[model samples]
Structure formats: structure tokens, C-alpha cells
Target: MIDSAVALPQGRRQRNKARVQERLFEAAVELIARHGYDNTSIDEIAARADVARGTFFNYYPRKDDLISEWSARRGTELRRSLVTEAGGLEPGDTVSRFHRCLAALVELNEDRQEVNRSMVTAAVRAGCLGARESATAELFTAILTDGQARGEIGEGLDPDRLGLLLRDAYLGVLTRWAVGAEQDHASLYRELHEVFKVFLIGALPRTAHRDCCPHTA
Candidate 1:
């Protein structure tokens, strides 16, 4: 086995790389918010982060890659929250878990509306939000797969397609809220909640329990 001391430098290098990547994300997000995504360039991002262009590429192959990483990180955080809220993805608590995740995300975005809008614009232009191979899609697909296995959700549906649909709908609401007026944030949150409310109901198995239909009037 390799000596722990020998591996220490490698661990340090990994930590340094993560720090540099985080700085680049902060710089790029700020610039994109101020100058718009199309106008922001790699060189500018490097300059803002006070790093060389090559260093930026070492972390992210391209600007789109950076945006995808940011979106994926957010998705992972949401999944963590869902697991925590629902006690590890209990299929019967799917609707409640989704609500908790959305509420947390909305509360987060409400504090950084402009940055959220810029990020959404970049994500849309880069087509990262809908990427089938994205972490965001993978997480949702896993959720649906487990739900189906537990007979808590529709079994006939393709989990991958359903995952993409759910992701797209989420992006749509997020983008709308990011671009909408501050005064309308509450209303927009309601719209987002309603969208998922409908989705959860629709995704239920035909023989789902009455408790599964959380939106019953």
C-alpha cells in the first residue's frame, strides 16, 4: 500500500483544485450576471478569478462545462435535502420530499434573484439543463426507479423520460422566477409549487393510496 505521507500532497493538490474551481465559478457567475452569458468569455472569467486561462480549462473544459457543473452541484444538494426530509427516499413520501426540496430551493433563489437568472440563462444557452447524462437527470431517474420498484408510482412510465420531463418543468419554473419581478416572487413560488403538485399527482400509480394525492381538495 502507498504511504499516507506520499498521498498527502495529492490530497492537497485536489483541495487546491477545488478552491480554484470555486473561485472561477464565483467570478463567472458575477460576470454573467452583470454582462450576460453570451458576452462573458473564458479569458474574462480567468481575469476576474485572477487565474490563467489554462488554469480555467484545467478545471472546466469549456464555459458550458462550468455551467453544467454548477447545475449538477445544485441538483446534488437538492437530492441530499430530499433524502434527509423524506428519511432516505421513502417512495410513499415522494410528494412531501419534493415539496421540501422545492421550498428550500425557492427560499435560496429568493435571496439571489439576479444571480439565479444569469445562471439559468447560461444553463439554457448551453443546453445543460436538459442533458440526459446530467446528474440532475440521474437523481430524478433514480427516484422514479425506486418509486416504481416500491409500487408507489406509475409502473408503465419510462423513468428516464419522466426524469427529463420533471427536470425540464423545474427549469422552466426556476427560469421564470429568476426573471420575474421581486414583487412577484411569492406568486411565482405558488406557480412552481402548483406545477410539481400536479406532477406528483399525475405520477402516482392508478391504485395509489388516497394519501399519495396530496393536492386533493
Candidate 2:
């Protein structure tokens, strides 16, 4: 799900740095997912990654940097799914495409609910959740901008603002799911869709057709 925009590092030093960063992210995520965020520390993460404590700090100045990297990957995966669901330049149903994209994201992360919960907690504590320039928000904003141009979304709303709001809403639901998943993942998924329905209503124009909205001139 990596975007082509991110090129692989050519030099040995750069490659090694990238590899170490990835290992740190993987180790941190695994630990945080299994144990709660507060329960996991820089020492634990460094040990899990088999790197020295100083090495970990060299790659990531703060523990939250690992979580932020993981979040960016998740956002990229979701964005890729959305692009694929759009059928690549074909006239597509934005609503259906969006649902499919969201479904893919939920399916991808459903098994790691505890990890998601921990990540959310850590992100909030580190103020990462408030970052408007996050990959997740950027991707949503791009999609919403297209939807607005195509008359699939409400004209009155600013695409960037609406996108941020939608992203926040989804993140909120994700936190809720991570914290309150006493039942099966399917039940929690249903709640996500229900919340999305409200978002759809808010985002779409009132005159939008039941099946798919008509394009504007």
C-alpha cells in the first residue's frame, strides 16, 4: 500500500536507517498491541527491536514517532484501497467506493483491536491525533475535494474542513471500537458503518440521487 512517491533509499547508510526505523515501528506496534501503551516503554520497544536504547532515540526522538509512522502506513493502505475502489479513472459511485475503502480498512485492522486501542491512546497523549497534516487527513481531503468537484458532496462545505471532520469522526469510532469491543468485530463494524451513515448524510448534497449522485457541469 506504499505510494510510489516514496522512493527507496539507494545508499547503504540510508537503507540501514530505513531498515532500523521499520524494525522499531514493527517492534513497538507489536508490543503496544499486546500490552497497553502505558505498559510499554522505550526500553521495552528498544529491547524488542534488538536495538540499543541510544539507537532507538537516534531513529525516533520520541516513542510516539513509531506510532505516528505506523499510523501513516495505515493511512496509506486506506488511501490505496480507496483509489482501487474508485476503479481507476472510471466513473464510479463515490459512496460505494468510500464504503468499500472503509470496509477494507476495518477488515485489515479488526484482528488488532488491542493494538489500535493502544495506538489511539498513545497518539492522543502525544498530540498526534491533532495533526491536521497527517497522511490520513490529507488522503481524506483529496478524496473529498474530488467528490465536491464531481457534485457528489455538499457544495456548501469546504472540502478540507469536511475531510478533517470526517477523519476525526472515523478516528473517534476507531477509539470507541478499541475500547468497547466486548462483542465480535462484526458488531463493532456495524457501529462504524452507522456512524458513517451520519457522515454521508452530512457530506452529500440533499438532491443527490439514491443510487449515485449526478455530476455537476
Who wins the TM-score comparison? 2
Identify the runs in model 2 with alpha carbons over 4 angstroms from their true place. 1-6, 84-91, 202-217
lDDT of 2 at 76: 61
Give lDDT for model 1: 0.74
Please report, as a residue range, the 10-residue window in candidate 1 with the lowest summed lDDT.
84-93
- Give the least accurate 10-residue stretch of model 2, judged by summed lDDT: 83-92
- Count of steric clashes across candidates, in order: 0, 0
What TM-scores do the predictions have?
A: 0.75, 0.81
Each candidate's lDDT (Cα)? Answer: 0.74, 0.74
Which pairs, if any, clash in model 2? none
